[model samples]
Target: MKVYLWVDKDIPNVYGQVAVRAGSIDEPADFTGLAHYLEHMLFKGTQEIGALDWAKEKPMYEQIIKLYDEKAKLRDPKKDKAKRDELTKKINELSVASSKISKGSEFPTLIQAAGGTGLNAYTNFDQTVYHNSFPAYQMENWLKLYYDHFQRPVFREFQAEMENV
Candidate 1:
């Protein structure tokens, strides 16, 4: 990770950005939009940051991924409409259950509560960037949040987040 800082006495807030080299270009051709989907998931928070019960949520989260994998394997959506619909229903059911135990918006909520603004992320062909502005004194807090943000992202609320992407 690389860091850059710009300080100005007149500005009351600190604007921070963390950009990673991976983006759409890094995604596998078969999985186009994977990078953009990841950008959205990263905000969903990590194992330590978002889960009310990681032990329970983990299994459901895994099941959701498996269902998606299974759904993806159905080469003919129209022909396999019945099977695809079943998988979609299962995915949605587990997603809602998993969400109950997950802190879906805790990451952004924490930032907003701390006087942070412009909290958002974006992905392009070459890179993805997460950024926000916060009171200068909260620099340490911002660093800690982001440090945990990048570690072990849980992918909770996968279905709802997928809609956003």
Candidate 2:
């Protein structure tokens, strides 16, 4: 990863951005909105940040992933309405269960607690960028949080996030 630092003594806040080369253009043709969906999922947080009980949540989350995968495979929803609806119902059920053990929005909550602002990310045709500005004194906290963010992002609210995408 390439790191860029701009130090301005007069500024009270430090702005950090991490951009990845992959974006909508990188998604498989069949999975058009996947990149954007991923952008939303990244904020859901990792095991260390979002989960109150990862042990119990992991299996339920895996089931949700599997259901989504199956749903994705059934191309024509009209033709496979029964199967698709079944999968959708299961995904929703698992998501609700998973949410029970998840600390939803904890990632941004942490940043806000540390005096951060503009905590957001965007996905474009060629790249996806995550960024935020934090009080200069909170630089260390920002770095550690983002490091964990990229290293171990969990798809906690997949179905709900997909709706936003």
Candidate 3:
């Protein structure tokens, strides 16, 4: 469901947001922080938004995940230094390889280029909301970007985003 408010004021910008009823409070105890983490990922991109070449990048991205999974099982980096360093090196290599195919910021850049402003999203106790203001004439463009975001989002930059969290 989508909701829109058409203000009749003289302002030249249109303000709106897409929200879901689910939030942090709805998450299971073991999945705490999941909602906010997902919110952060949404900005990372959609398949078509932040990708420079999905065909080439996909394999590299998968490799990163695989490497990290193996790394996770290693115990005490100080004692498992050799294995830890090996996995980290491989992960870094894949990250660099995949990053080269990244458009990285195509989402927000698309909106900003089209005269959209205040593009942002947040998650809290009861809801996660994505909001943006666009020039009145750019409403259609805004919708196009927003729909792309939700319909085909890709979780890029997971490592960097997780660190920030």
Candidate 4:
């Protein structure tokens, strides 16, 4: 394995997140919430940040589950927005107790901190990730925290993060 690491940490801000080895294409069958739900739930972190409070957030996550499910079959825009909005609200409410922080703001900070600039992300049918590369001096550190997040991320503000996006 090519163990990736960030070697630089100068400047100011530093943000990090993880991209799972799995993606929508890898979602299991018979499990409606397989991929998107897993994506949502993935933010539920490890022992480091704190245990995932699924009890309180389950309903909100479920709402996102519903939105995603409905959005998939949705052919009507009006109904879709309403459904999406409702689910988004639940997610926001639950986010207060989650670790699904915003990747948009986070990754850029990693770049800026390492004394580089500009960072962003994307998703496709097959996968999704946080991606940024910079000057040779800032290479590893620019990407370090992201890998760190992979091991111990808390899906804290997924919907809130989504709202900002």
Candidate 5:
């Protein structure tokens, strides 16, 4: 059965989250970070939330991968200066394009329309959490914002999401 809850100061706030009960540890070695990436994408919202222009989001998302890929290379104490600089350039290019997707976009405006703030989401080692804290009256709006994504999502791409962490 469907249920509802809230989290706030006045009335008691209630909400829900899904626990996968597994993670990268359970995936095939070839899958590597696939599980981790999928965790992040889960919150990309779904067809129901709104259309996710993946065509355009893809290029932006790829740069996100470049950003993380460069960071990974930098971690090596013996990493070559030339190679590092090359990756850095790619990352910068991608970061710039990715920022465009987030600039004053309607998504932020709609999420805020729910009558609350701090409606955010995250992915972790063994879990993916999608939640928000709003005043009691915003339950329906909040639910609409969260439902389709929680039910089924279309994330930009895991490679893009890694940039956030």
Candidate 6:
């Protein structure tokens, strides 16, 4: 709740933002881009937004990760192209299967529906920020949205987002 406000009567809308003091500088050497990855994942959706039935999706997700690990171990491109391609195909199929039951992009859609503008986030050396602009009267709605957004965001679509990164 560390909100810093700059009030000006000339403007009809308010620019609100949230930032966490964790970024690349805070990431471990072995996981250099984890923080930035997390920043990107934040928009993918929370548990309530982008999610499938956990009871069924969990086991498949685990199997996909295991397959990816196995593929990584055989990293010689020229020597393992066929095997790698097979593993990749399997991963993609599993991902699509999992996604079939999940819902995503709900958060941004909510903001947009509320007339929010500039809905986005970014990660830099020392911080990760999520920000948006809304009409002055929507402050209460904004607070609630922020609360739900950060409470427990589910890392949905990990493989796709990782590929994007």
Q: What is the lDDT of residue 140 in candidate 6?
A: 83
Clashing residue pairs, backbone N/CA/C < 3 A, model 6: none
- Steric clashes per prediction: 0, 0, 0, 13, 4, 0
Off by over 4 Å in 6: 4-11, 51-93
Which regions in candidate 1 have their CA more than 4 angstroms from the true location? Answer: 5-12
Structural RMSD, model 1: 2.2
Model 3: per-residue Cα lDDT at residue 117: 83
Task: Tell me how far the alpha carbon of residue 92 in candidate 2 is from the true structure, in angstroms, after superposition.
Answer: 1.4
Per-residue C-alpha lDDT of model 3 across residues 28-98, encoded as one tens digit per residue: 89779999998888887777898989888888877888888888889796888999899888887888778
Listed per candidate, the RMSD to the true structure in angstroms reads 2.2, 1.9, 2.9, 8.4, 6.9, 3.8
Give the clashing residue pairs of candidate 5, or none: 5-14, 6-13, 6-14, 7-13
CA shift at 125, candidate 4, in angstroms? 2.3
Model 2, span 56-141: residue lDDT tens: 99999888877878887897858999998888888888888889999869999999999999998999999999999899988878
Backbone clashes, candidate 1: 0
List the candidate 3 regions with Cα displacement exceeding 4 Å: 3-11, 68-86
Q: Write the per-residue lDDT of candidate 5 for residues 7-91, one digit (tens) a residue.
A: 4566644444434555666668866776766655665545444344546755665566756666765756565766777766776
- Candidate 4 all-Cα RMSD: 8.4
Best by TM-score: 2
What is the Å distance of residue 151 in model 3 from its true position?
Answer: 1.8
Taken over the whole model, the C-alpha lDDT of each candidate is 0.88, 0.88, 0.84, 0.50, 0.56, 0.82
Ranking by lDDT: 2, 1, 3, 6, 5, 4
Ordered by TM-score, highest first, the candidates read 2, 1, 3, 6, 5, 4
